[model samples]
Target chain A: MGVGTGNTVLKVDGVTKTFGGLRALDDLNLTIEEGTVHAIIGPNGAGKSTMLNVCIGQLKPDTGTVTFDGEVITGKQPFEINQAGVSRVFQTPAIFEDLSVLQNVMIPAIAHRDGKFKLNPFSILEKQDDIEGRAVEILERLRLTELMDKHAGSMSRGNKRRLELAMCLVQQPRLLLLDEPTAGMSRHDTNRTIDILKQIKEGGMTKVIIEHDMHVVFSVADRISVLARGHIIAEGTPDEIKGNPVVQEAYLGGSVE
Target chain B: MKKFFANQWLVMLVFSAVILTMPIWLSPIGAGYPDLLQKFMIFGIFAIGFNILFGLTGYLSFGHAAFLGVGSYAAVWSFKLLTMNVLPAIIFAIIVAGLFSVVIGYISLRRSGIYFSILTLAFAQMSYNLAYSVLTPVTNGETGLQLERADPRIIDSLFVEPTEGLPLTNFFSLSLSGYEGFYFCAAFLIIGFFISLRIFRSPFGLKLRAIKSNQTRMQYTGFSTKPYLLSAFVISGMYAGLAGGLMAATDPLAGAERMQWTASGEVVLMTILGGVGTLIGPLLGVGIIKYFENIFSAINENVLMAAYSGLPEGLQHFLVTVSSPFVGEGWHLTLGLMFMLVVIFLPGGIMEGFDRIKRLLMKPFSRNKDAVESAEEGH
Candidate 1:
């Protein structure tokens, strides 16, 4: 599939992040267009997670700039970045484990709808039909309506990941970041997750994902960027990445020649 | 819909009924019974407020007693300078405590988890020391603030009759004494309890739980966790202040020991023993601990020997001496043991222990229902 839709949502220019003597990200340059899935693949300690963190405001880069929707967000707080409509899901299912699934989803929904935290006891939460309706609709989309009343902690790993996605999706973010969304899943679960992600992309949400599994990267990614030692060595379509000799040697650890 | 009512008004009604009638039931036992019940309700309010911060947020502050002391001192000062009208004194006390919490919380929440708890503890110790020495004019130099009988009543102070030697109310010869004082304190406890209940059900309450679980996730979900945490802190502090104010209202005395770190620790024990995160658990905890302090402390060798006297002299002396430390002033030893057992065996508290018994009793009746639900949920 073709990228470069002329609607770049995230533009990272000459970004570098360093920790003490080590360079986690070195002059990383990338542009993720709107309504597409952009995947980054590399070995361990490749700074894939760091890049996502910087974009989502969890970490700040040492050098270079990040522009999202024509606004500089290089050093903003994570909550500020989130309020600007960028959201992320962690590798592990980070949810309020004790709260019910419905309550979990309602948290971000309440923050989004109310603009500030409302603590009035007299205000009936059950009367908020709009919020409830939207939450139910999102839960239905993820087939989690039946599990809404259940504690989020007890859900299986696959369902937990799905629930995390639902939480991120409920915010209706402009750009979504997924950090190893299918990291520990079986092959079948991985494929099923790819299908869910494909649906998310088809619904016109821009995505930046870091994946170690090349099968998942190739299955849904509109464009692929191969990173080695914290630098993007190649950026191309799936076929170009699959055939690139340098990428094969650097990433696949061998060459067919 | 019926289940919803159970979740709402049923709890309120039970709390109200217990607060209303507890002193009456206890007063017939002795002259000091109402006073003991009043103390229980006052501390119950304190723990319920404290649970919002510690139990809900999982921030174990070891200095919360400072707010209690602040409230008591503020209320006593109001009686000293302005008037003995409990309403304005309570309002002033709570506002001062809320403002104090804002400053402390802003600084303490900067470091989370263990750091936050330690920081709060340090602040509380600082307050205790300052009250004992540095802030002599304000805190009265450990002598504690006492209500002056001849103090001017500038603003509708509690009308007192010299004959009764206590505050009195007009019409029907009613007075704010004996069971009436206990009832007044009980009403405040009911209000504090319901307010806590509302806070537990609100969306803000859910976010507080989320912050407790994973604050980073909450931050990414567009919540500045600081504001929520700060608000919870202020609300909890105000609740403690209200309890302190009511304590002074009932007794008209304030002491520096009220703000001691051990006092703060006592409330923590109360919350954990009753069931941290359970709405009614803190009340149960405060009631149990207070009962132990009042009733168990009254149990002496004479009472014990009187009951088990015919069981030979050696056995009687052995039992009374062995249990002596747990009775009559060392009752906190028993409380400490109770807290340890509850924490170790039932980390969920007395509520969890009660729940275990309930599940055991219901096992045979709901076997198929639980089996079906557990299978579907997949653990």
Candidate 2:
């Protein structure tokens, strides 16, 4: 409820999505500010993913308008939405597994700068040094510089998730959407991820994260929205969300104290 | 350009040397004849193009031969109306086949995996039936579309009248028959191989491999995979078309059977047997299969007897009896056995077999080098 303070970069208004007999998303309204970490926490089947999918244009809403940077992105193609500077990391690690770590990051970097499609049949070799330099810089920042040549698929699940984030971040997206970014990670890896995300936050890009871990949500989120039965039930800062009776009853199960 | 040649020039040089000197080396193996050599180059191009789609993109097209047949028909029509020049025939075939691929690729690429393959198969079968029956006016049905002495040659009026002998397809004054025909096809094959090498290392090629790895991931990565796949399909189809046109130019006939599903399967077999994704693997597969088709099938009883004459009387008889099923009229049986062995022992195909052999050969040399280095360090 009016939690976002800065200029709104993404606005989802009256969005409803239904799959056959199931109403996955119902009259969902969300606003993500230009430079903040907004976390969406919900129970199973609470439509966190559905909202992310709608924003990324993976699933068209039954009735609503989703706008990004003043442009309606409700029915646009996934690539078109991505071209509009909205990037998503899936729940599971969705990366070009067969490609090396460098290539995995380079692909998005190329797509980011070159637009959707370029013939580029002859310039790969000439462009390799520059691309690889950029890729190496990203890998260094992620502390994955040593594994740059390793296949993305062969890496650990936690590292794959990191690589996926590196791929998304290399695009320098205006709006980043991450679905369970730290799912299945060890505590150490989760902390490392928190640190990386903290660095990313300092870079001043708006991020909408769907998270199940309360630790991650409380640690990183500037604003937290609690969802139950496909609607936002509570929205506030971390302290407010932790103390809110409605959020505790709906998601936290009881009072944290 | 310098970087392009850094990794590929050696391969290009070796390929050129082997293809250009085929007559000298193949004579000892009895595959030196022009017709067999020409078939080798034509099928080599076909398999190479097929690899661009099936091998790189991982979209197995079951009806690729339709493009080949379309190309042949286009070339034949060019011959009928235009001059006997092979240039126009080859060019027209490529254009027609490219157009045909665009239609088929647009429809079939809407689905993927097995469903995509089935769609292509259905389209190819439909084209085959139409060519055999309804489109007989163009294809000439079972007898096939053949060059006729009475047909108009509009481009060059030098030989308009009916002649007793058949006119050969030519490039200027030189005829496209005998060694010249083999050389012509070989030239195209080499050029195709170089183009394939470029594609394999290109940025577009990386996108195709990405699609093969994960289509969902590629789509979300801001790539419209449909256009990339369609481009690959059309490019591959044109490769098939170029091969078909070369076939017509060499022999002056386009048959409905060229569009048969078996012909499509043959190119797939060639690509898989040599190695699915390697640059020269498809061509190597083509050479092996064509060699068996020509030389293996040509080994009559007399040749078998001569081959075994140096052995003991009992052993010679036994050897000939045992090998008879694998040679001459039974070459297909040999091919089947070879395919099974390759599939079982070398799933990566003949290139994998070659790689294994190379590694085996290098093992001892590497060990010896390491030992020598250690001894020098001790001193």
Candidate 3:
């Protein structure tokens, strides 16, 4: 269940992250309000992932403030940021392949619910009924209840994406940062993922998704920001971004007459 | 209900049962089964600890035996100064090894993959060299450290003596007779097995595996993987120390050779050969290697000659010449060959082979059920 009203939950102000001489992200500034699906659209090497990394503390911006719920979390460790309610799903499904899908989802849920790294040998699964019940519900929402017993590695790419999304959802994260949620999916699977995202947003979760597919972005994005050369060129509602000259120039090439 | 056997705990329980029953079943055969079994269990403990570090974290440590050696030395020192109590000795060994692993893991983990392995190996070699030369009084140099009968143990406790001419301890208290020591070793192995099982199921263990699979991803998930990796390294090192402490308890000695690079290689071989990630594979690998070392190495030319009387003269002579290298001294060559074969053919070790056979047997029936389910779903 996504928490909070759609007021500004995360603020990234004038953030710049550079690797050696190459500017991965240049003077990026964006404010994500609570309870809305925000889409970051850009081409390859467009610094989309870098911006996500900076926001979540995987990478430090050379100069900028990333404030989540009013705390400066720019240089914090990934886990610390995660504990603060920012969860990320990787481009490639990063799941425990050998573990059952239930165990895979159970791990992060347990970590979040217990609020500490657990060391006791007692059955954590047994003790955590609410977490387990919620995880099962999330899996059901994704139509992954039947695959709960299957090894995560045994699943196809589409199913793995669902599993990753389920893991993030099960954490009940404040802001779920997804990198290409439908990266390697077929058309049917992409549409299904869009449907899932639509349902999640409808259910009141704040999501920031980076997608290469313009169709996927247009389908569920409440606000669209067009990023070009490490800076946001335009930010508005879907209709405005769709008609903006800069956005068209950035995506369609050359100056629009 | 029948499918419950697929649970990891059930497999571990079966393994523990087999390891525990070895002495009882094999002692009647009059072969030195108990002695071999004890050695296997000790090395098995060593490999299990090693598998946690190398298998779970994907950190290949080539210097792990340094911790084992450190444990042995720590136990021997405790034996020399404190009580002859095995508990204190083991505790000291574990603490020392854990500390050593921390220092090593810290430096080694800074680099990933092959560099990490090389760093560990270099550190281990340094440890071995220092123990052999610079640390003469503490390590006792080439002669290694040995128990003197005159060394005063504050709390006088009697331990079982070693078997005749074996020059090691018996069970915990009785003496180092083959039967008693074997059981003592078996008991510790079972304990180590359970501890490993706990570590595997713990949340900490889950994080360690996550680090192995995707360190960067784990970090992004808000877990600093360094501490988790280091903690696992120390825990595994403590297991190595326990194995070393048991060795000291049995033989009451510590040698630089125990921490040698070859010893490190042997444990890696054991873990890989048995099944790198599987719980029981390392023990099986240890048993396989030790079996060749203890039993095959004992077969000499005289033994071969004794058996030759039953064969034709030319065939007997040919057999002796061809088999000479594999028996008595060259058994390690055979072991190396076996390791290579296992690595190549059974990459998952005995566990993979076992799983393959099980899957093959279940496949025909299992596939039909899945097909039937889909057929029903279509309706």
Model 3 chain B poorest 10 in a row by lDDT: B162-171
Fraction of the native A-B contacts that model 2 recovers: 0.64
* Interface C-alpha RMSD per candidate, 1 decimal: 1.8, 1.4, 2.7
Q: DockQ, in order, for the candidates?
A: 0.64, 0.59, 0.44
What is the descending DockQ order?
1, 2, 3
**Every model's TM-score on chain B:** 0.89, 0.93, 0.88
> How would you encode candidate 1's per-residue C-alpha lDDT over A115-225 as one tens digit per residue?
545555455566667777888888998889999999999999988888888898988988999989998888888888888888877668888888888788888898889
Name the runs in model 2 displaced over 4 angstroms: A1-5, A254-257, B1-6, B158-164, B359-379
Q: Which scores greater on TM-score, model 1 or model 2?
A: 2
Give the C-alpha lDDT of model 3. 0.81
Query: What DockQ does candidate 3 have relative to the true complex?
Result: 0.44
Tell me the TM-score of candidate 2's A chain. 0.95
Better of 1 and 3 by DockQ: 1
Residue B260 CA error for candidate 1 (Å)?
1.2
**lDDT, candidate 2, B1-379, per-residue tens:** 3354557778799889999999999999988999999999999999999999998899999999999999999999999889889999999999999999999999999999999999999999999999999999999999999988878878756654545776778988889999999999999999999888888887788888888988887777888889999999999999999999999999889998999899999898899899987777898999999999889999987898999999999999999999998899999999999998998999889989988998898999989997997899799
The model with the greater DockQ, 1 or 2, is: 1
| CAPRI class of candidate 1 | medium
